[model samples]
Target: MTVLLFGITKDIVGSSTLSLPVSSTSRLRTVGELKDYLSSTYPRLRNLSSLAVAVNNSYAEDSDKIDNFDEIALIPPVSGG
Candidate 1:
């Protein structure tokens, strides 16, 4: 699956596109899993839960199932304007 990045997530990912070894058929089922994936890929993102997430341009939950080709992004909270 591909996760669109924003804010500091791009820096952590080192690029805009992340072709992870995720199941394209079964999207990310939980935030914990995604966090794990991120941690495995980018060690700096291990504590991803400190941030927020958005699936397909909307706020996502811990149990949300990311669908195929879904646009997922790590909507980290901004500290200031």
Candidate 2:
């Protein structure tokens, strides 16, 4: 699965996009699982107060299901006035 990173998430990951190997033995099925995997792989991600996941250009909840071909993006909290 490939995930697009935005704002601080991109800075933390050091890339605009991230690729996760999908195998029969280990497949990330839910959005929550993806978050855990990302946080584990990129410890800095865990520091963020809010990290939103978007699937196919739509906001997704923790319980949402994810597929390898899905369009995923990580949206970090934005503050401006």
* lDDT top scorer: 2
The segments of candidate 1 whose C-alpha lies over 4 angstroms from its true place after superposition are 21-27, 47-49
Looking at model 1, how many pairs of residues clash? 0
Worst 10 residues of 1 by lDDT: 19-28
TM agreement with the true structure for every prediction: 0.75, 0.94
Off by over 4 Å in 2: 24-26
What tens-digit string does per-residue lDDT give for candidate 2 at 30-65? 999999988988999999999999999999999999
lDDT tens per residue, model 1, 1-81:
777777778888888766666453355577657866677768887655576778788887877777556777877657766
Query: Which TM-score value belongs to model 2?
Result: 0.94
Per-candidate Cα lDDT values, in order, are 0.71, 0.91
RMSD of each: 2.6, 1.6
